[model samples]
Target: MSDAAVPDLTELLADSPTNWGKWGPDDEVGSLNYLTAEQVLAGAAQIKKGKVFTLQRLIGDPKGDPVWPGRNPAVREMTLDESHWDEGNNGPAFPGGMHCADDTLTASLQGSTQYDALGHVWYDGKIWNGFDARTTIGGLSKASVAPIAERGDAGRAVLLDIARHRGKEYLEPYETFTHEDLVACAEAQGTPIRPRDILVVRTNHLQLFFEKGDKFYSDFCEAGLVYSPELVSWFQEMEIPNLVTDTIANEVTMDPHNGAALVLHSALMRNLGVAFTEICDLEKLATDCADDGTYSFFYVAAPLKISEATGSPVNPVAIK
Candidate 1:
């Protein structure tokens, strides 16, 4: 398809408001319900075409401190004599009966709570343009919301590593990123910001969470780093579809005592048709794009089919 044939960002957002809605932290389960067999084929074709880079975070336990908020529960325990299977009730009953197996598996990618699709959240109890949330995906189903499928594919994606562009692997506590920062990063990379792009930002906070141990979550909550309201307004004006990042909450951590939540979430998912992606791995892609001066790519994501659940585990990929 020619570039001209590609839908404009505003048109894409207007036609599929829920497309931007799938990447949020609080989007309703099953709000993204447009997964068609053709999308799966398109993704498979990209993989076959090569030059595609995988961006999903590895879903295994790391030996060091917790990479996220939860503990690693995959360690194996020593087996006692009684725990071993006896070959003989009185004598040897089976050959290989004395063998032992680990039988333990670690969980990666929290599926029980997936990223909310842009159509997932609603302001004034409604989604974009007064679509009722309860009657939509937020109300009846868990697999996907209306217009969005169980999985989503076929959109333009762009990466803006704000922290990296600032020459740091991470941002400081409570630092609010601005629209200028985003534009500056794109400029530095020589990639102009375009509308209808699925934008991914790298804070490198995931690495800090792994390094800080127990202090990570508390410190993050206290730091209050996030996007400003103006930035949200900018996205709506630009008509961007989806936004993905490495942070779990998709906004600056709130004040623990005050409970001030992510205003960006309210502005994007609630007001505009933009959604978010949390816990993404953009380090390698960002580094490469920054060096090569190419940041646009074909993006795709697939969510598991867990009925009535808040969210399912997803593995989203990007092809440059």
Candidate 2:
């Protein structure tokens, strides 16, 4: 294709990590292709005790706390028809019909446990697999989050508890890790990441939020993986496909690769095409894994099929 037709996304692709044509030209699911039937089967095989862990947080408004400026916390309004109300207060939801209630939910999909669609991140004017974001900017149209639901988000999930491995309950905010640190954690935790596995790294990034509440967690910076070209390269080399964390931003706020500025997101989500999951509640799962000496589980997540949308909310489950 001529430069005019293609727009020379080579520099953007080269500068950041990407999976432009890895699956194919028309591919929209990005690295999600890694979760194949075989991969799904492998995930299923890991379930021994049939124990289950819900990895999503209880998503409610932070008691009306201003978590972020302008972004409204999720609000749930429940309604019951007057016909359902009875004599005093315990009346049936419906006078003649069965009692029923309805809820209207206003949510920030990515506010809690969620998988970020490939379309959710873009660089150099294009998305993964060469989709022009300008034309497909209609959220779920181009690289929509809905496809993640089709894929079933089912696979093997491995938790690399960095804090536990380091003999601590949590890493201090702003503590970041390089590729070597990941490898070390893998070794220390005895968790080997296999291809086609979904990786969940727990750095105890959410401890502050739990201990001190939203104000402290929102006010302060947090610790996470050190973002760098080298870290991106490591993910590509391992081909693990997806990563979720108990972190608001999957990586630390500052860039470690000489100031690439969210290059970690670009490399992993945009370039390499790994569907990224963020803000997951991994505290319970981490504790369970550490107690049982098990880190592998069958993981399942299905994002809302909001067609052409940039991203959607999800509640991923881990079956032990």
Candidate 3:
């Protein structure tokens, strides 16, 4: 679609609901507030067999890492190594002539498994909690990942294996699922959606990216939850605190109907104050869940406490 034909997010979400001031003006963590002590205990109660799974994808996978277009995978540069401590090299020597390896990594905060600040995306001139978008000028002055890191994320989480439900290794490009589809998938998996439950959805969509490499972005549409007023309302009613997904963007890359991209970022994250955890590696978690028929688990994660960051890399943990 031509840029002229695309509808502005402001127009698309003109009547969308917002949680502004709902948690008071100073609140930055948004719906995460739903993860109360009771929710944490309920999550712990679901742990069985003590199996653990880490949801962060390898940062520098040799085979290549998937990232949103216009972004690059993490690059690690060795700053100090055994090579630097060679006989003639001027490597810094410690008391015992000890040399330790060190490396520096450069990457986009949202380029890997990450948690987006509530103010990460917005329409008009406002962000989550009605903060001015200008607050993000140099770095986020409000609703940055710092607050989320301090509070932490630990609660009952349910995994919805949409690929398994559809009997496919992965959903095809541009495919979409709705809230109703989620309900049905939950029914099939025997995992009912509950209020304040953290949702971990797996489509294994990045399989294509790993397989096709640059070719994966030829058309560049992702299979994910498309936007709708009803879907937004469902999230609000369910009081979802976090949405973790194995996709570049948690929601469809572009709304098929209106051509507006990432409407849910505004509808869910910005407006409803729902936290978004994207680019997760859920293969192990989904496989374990499928084998054991236990899709819900105790989930926890805390992003790096980078000041004023829009997002932060996170390795979320799911325990069963």
Candidate 4:
């Protein structure tokens, strides 16, 4: 084909009918087969050429005085009931002690290093692909989220350092990042976005949260650091399949009127049939990879097999 007639990656994805018609009620969205184990291994090999950055926080007891005035589940103590164990002559006589862990867990929701499934968000009481938000988040299983599952291995991954692009490591309170800001960052980095590509936005929020403590969380919520609806529409039009960022929620900020925060979660996860990753520490990854280039990697994640849970804690890795 002539250069003018040749379709780019974004155009090809946008033009695919399978991509557009894959959403259905009876399907599994998050499954291991999304990207085969072999594919994941290959991506890891490529990433090994450089250092592999870990994005997960240590899942242990919370530390330090709660300085951030936000809901933090990680700060809650994990408790175990020894009564469940069988009493032995000297101690509990059982191969393994039976105990229940504390449930009051809170930590970073969107930005601490996690993946947002298609069922993660809801708009007007409806989830992405028209799944009932109340029913799906409360009862759906991985097998039930199949429409999302078939389109697995969301092709390619792109990282954008908005904070660095603007000449700072952190954004001030209420500093809204518009779609133009993202495009400009891509332009500055000389990397154009492609469809089915997983886009990671680095706000350095996690670094600020770790360094400044709880004040950063309070200020972040008060300041409204999120993407606009127009920006969400841009991703949908571009046919990008995934979005990730270091924030509490996918939306730029919480809406007080409807008690909805992170509207982008609704727009993308619920409306655009796109998956999202939250609480990701992309600063290191972006720095290691350098923002001027795109990386073809295999993304892997295993969510807890909890039926009907709103969301489960997951550990996701990007192998390039």
Candidate 5:
């Protein structure tokens, strides 16, 4: 179909489900509310081996940090070093003339492994939980990532190595999966996705980005969950608090069925209030899970507390 034939997001998701007002009118974290203390305890119970894996990709990797198109990778510039304290030079004189290195980083908050606030995306002039889009004018005054960072997120997490499940090194561009596919992948991995579990999926798609450089963006659709009404409903029923994936966006770049861009962003995040944790490096976690035949683990992620920001960088950990 031509671009003109595709329905607008409003029309496409007009009748879709939403959790707005389900947690009350002022709720900012959305489905994350499902992560109760009971859930945290349940997650802790899964940590039998004490093996820990960090999921954040390097901020300034020489190989190149993969990010969403139109965003630049992070850059760290050193401001003070040993040279600053050279013979005649002075570096921050203290009681004992102490010297230390200092640096500053500049980059988009969502450039690396991140957690996007509920208000990051929207349609019909409204954001998550019926907040007006104007609330995001200067900065996200409503549904910002600060609330999530303040609260923190921890719970049971299950890894679904979709690439390995299908016997591929990595999923191809525009490759798609559904809730059914997630379930099938989990079953094949000898586990089941419990309700309120943080879903971590691995595709290792960035391997191509590191290998091909700019050519990776020539056709930039990512391999991830595709949106459908049934898929949205499934997420609603499952009470999933967070969706973590090794992809730029947590869903396919464009809906293959309707040609809509990041449909799940609006459907699942905006409507259902599901938190999105994207661009994770799940190689270590997936490798351990595959080797041990244990896919469930205790997952904890605490993003930076930048007020009213759309997202924040995070170094999540998975313990088995």
Candidate 6:
């Protein structure tokens, strides 16, 4: 965000309300610390019909129609005898020609449904809590995405279908919603924003992408929450441990305030120590929430165990 949009750094630091030292030294879990076992039990109580929704998009090659140029697309390969692994040449085959298959996948972890770890963002050569990123974040970092996966993020998930509240299938291109819009959405949905809850916002951009085309949508044209100091304050007030959205970026692709790139990524992940699950498929969730008038459910996200990575692919689930 622009310097004008953000408050004075000195003033913000002086009255910093971040959970830096609250979790103790060498703490990687940030707001996730608030997700107690009791809270998980309480979150599980939201389930009534036991309906499970997979929040991840299935990865696949797009048949030469990549959303973004040069970015890696999902590639699936077979490493076993199915791929011409002759026993005479490669000398590799299953015993008794059982033809057991082993497959390997090459894909971008953050290309589709993903999570941004605490170490994913860096500003001024430092990470969250002012740790030197050069040393603290490497192949093995201080705040890798692995721990969040190991723990299995589980809690109450609340869906804020802003598009539905606006009576639209999706928000328009490049539309920017504000913190006020979120409050209004919650009021309309009759769901209270609770602490340590996972927030899922449906912009329906995924619908547009699938309909209009990925390249058209991936060109940084979509609806999303705007980045502002007030947005940070909202996160602080809600104390949400995890955030997911159908939009490409968590915040608007182009800053409405100062034309900054991924400003919320830095402010939230790098400064406030909040993580994100971006580019999720929330169309069904939004439609269901609007239909049943039930926007709350049990959310669970278990990231792939890729140690020391800045982020990882995640298939977050919502059970209602």
Give the local distance difference test score of model 6.
0.74
Writing each residue's lDDT as its tens digit, candidate 6 over 50-144 gives 98899887677353222333467678887764546554556355588565567898876667688877877766676766667885534647778
Better of 4 and 6 by lDDT: 6
Q: Evaluate residue 114 in candidate 2 and report its C-alpha lDDT on the 0 to 100 scale.
A: 72
Task: Tell me the tens digit of each residue's lDDT in model 2 across 50-118.
Answer: 998887777773543223224556888776655447577665544565766777888776666677778
- List residue ranges in candidate 6 displaced over 4 A: 1-17, 61-70, 81-93, 136-140, 217-219
Sort order, lDDT high to low: 5, 3, 6, 2, 1, 4
Give me candidate 4's TM-score against the actual structure.
0.67
- TM per candidate comes to 0.66, 0.86, 0.98, 0.67, 0.98, 0.87
Can you write out model 4's per-residue Cα lDDT over 6-97, one digit (the tens) per residue? 43323332322222235445544522223345444544544535434555555542433222244454555445445434365243344574
- The number of clashing residue pairs in each candidate reads 26, 12, 1, 29, 0, 0
Candidate 5: where is the Cα deviation over 4 Å? Answer: none
The lDDT per prediction is 0.55, 0.73, 0.93, 0.52, 0.94, 0.74
lDDT of 4 at 57: 52
True-structure lDDT of candidate 4: 0.52
**lDDT of the structure predicted as candidate 5:** 0.94
Error of 1 at 139 (Å): 6.8
Q: How does model 1 fare in lDDT?
A: 0.55
How close is each model in CA RMSD to the real structure?
A: 10.0, 5.5, 0.8, 9.7, 1.0, 3.4
TM-score of 2: 0.86
Residue range with the least summed lDDT across 10 consecutive positions in model 5: 90-99
Could you tell which candidate, 1 or 6, scores higher by TM-score?
6
lDDT of 3 by residue, 108-189 (tens): 9999999999879888999999999999999999999999999999999999999999999998899999989998999899
